[model samples]
Target: MLSLVDSGSGTVVGRAEGEDIVLDVHTSGSGPALVLLHGAEGREANDAFIAALAERFTVIAPSHPGFGLSPRPDWCDSVEDLAYLYLEWLERQDWHDTMLVGLQFGGWVAAEMAVRDCSRLGRLTLVDPVGIKVGGREDRDISDVFAISRSELDARHYADPAAGPGDLSQASRDDVLHIARNEEALALYGWEPYLHNPRLQRWLHRIHVPTLVTWGAQDGVVSPDYGRAYADAIPGARFELVGEAGHRAQIEQPDTLAKLIAEHSA
Candidate 1:
């Protein structure tokens, strides 16, 4: 496992390698390893969720390449590339059969990793994963979050916009830059297929490990129907809906989400 020093807030921040790519990772708690993959916005924003999870298990949250302060490798242009990179990182850390959690775009990464190879992963939790064309092009499976304004995007992601991240207009310069980098990275990875892998559904059968799939009841970005479709694709996966929440359950319902994860992992 990667050795980490506390960041003075019950979390440890550090960098680790994934082949040629360097990832900024935060770790806390002390128990079985629990690797967390953040969404397009990066790890900094999920401090509450991370801390809550850290209370029960070791939480290893990593910022995707090109997001936050992490440098993106030239070759890392797709989610598939990210999956392999994470696999390499896991092997280097010698972590096996550990709990794995993914949120939003991170959930897409977790699904890809779980299906590709589950030897290193234990229980798997996917929170509103968006990475497949569930319906025909005429039917909107996922919202065009990239095409919308910041306020609109927030509105779609949270039942109460005030509970979500601060508006970009009111953000600090550093926060704005970080968001720009995150959006650029999201475009590089998910723009073409529009947040999905064409063949992922067909390979869901490969994920035999225990899985929990959760979604926000009021998710406008990707409806609960889409979340149900994802759970149905996986064998023996359980599906749940958190009421009064939208796409970002971790933000709106951290305590409840963390409790679910803790119980499921147990």
Candidate 2:
């Protein structure tokens, strides 16, 4: 079932970050540099979510090294490596006054980036972010939970049918299969003994930026316990539970998610 909707207008640029090919994405709307990172699903998975955000901010949403159309570099290993390359992108663009929003793995990217440099960042919001393993205290990593048939995709992504699944853009069968195949590769590269790096957790308290952590109330992917721990780990962080949603809270609850972001940025 193909759903018709308005795709964002933008220019895609292939920029070089050392040996890596970085995609320098520019899109509509105007404001500070709001960088968005998609979860393991793929960058395109969050296009509509980002487009809704692009209306109020100069959104700079990039595909991670391998995901989406961007060329994945060999040197990029840990999510920490990803953080460094993204900072390089900012330096290249000479951008400042930024807000960062991340989903799932992308949220980990935001957490990782904040620990590195919070000086340029104004606000941080994470939707079902995966940076550290919550250990049943609060959140559970979806990488540990997504072992089922393809049909389970709907229930896992969104609880509210009205808002539609996170992948509401309804990708072509071939495209959907192609992206799903790559997610396995992502899981292989990113999944570890633990859902996150122990070393990375130590750096969370160092972030002084005003942070907002959100999770789907029904997020079996990464349990709510994990989400609370994430918020508690960070300095001055507030965690919110987006009810009736699961891993893809923003995609399932875009309006609620957007309002939280707007409030945080404001």
lDDT scores of the candidates, listed in order = 0.84, 0.71
On lDDT, the leading prediction is 1
Task: Give me the displacement of residue 148 in model 2, in angstroms.
Answer: 2.5
Q: Which stretches of candidate 2 lie over 4 Å from their true place?
A: 1-20, 24-26, 136-146, 160-171
- Write down the TM-score of every candidate: 0.92, 0.83
Local accuracy of candidate 2 as per-residue lDDT tens digits, 111-161: 888899877778889888877765654534554534654446556656753
TM-score, cand. 2 vs. native: 0.83
Q: Residue 122, candidate 1: how far off, in angstroms? A: 0.8
Q: lDDT per residue, candidate 1, 190-234, as tens digits?
A: 998899999999998899889999999989899999999999999
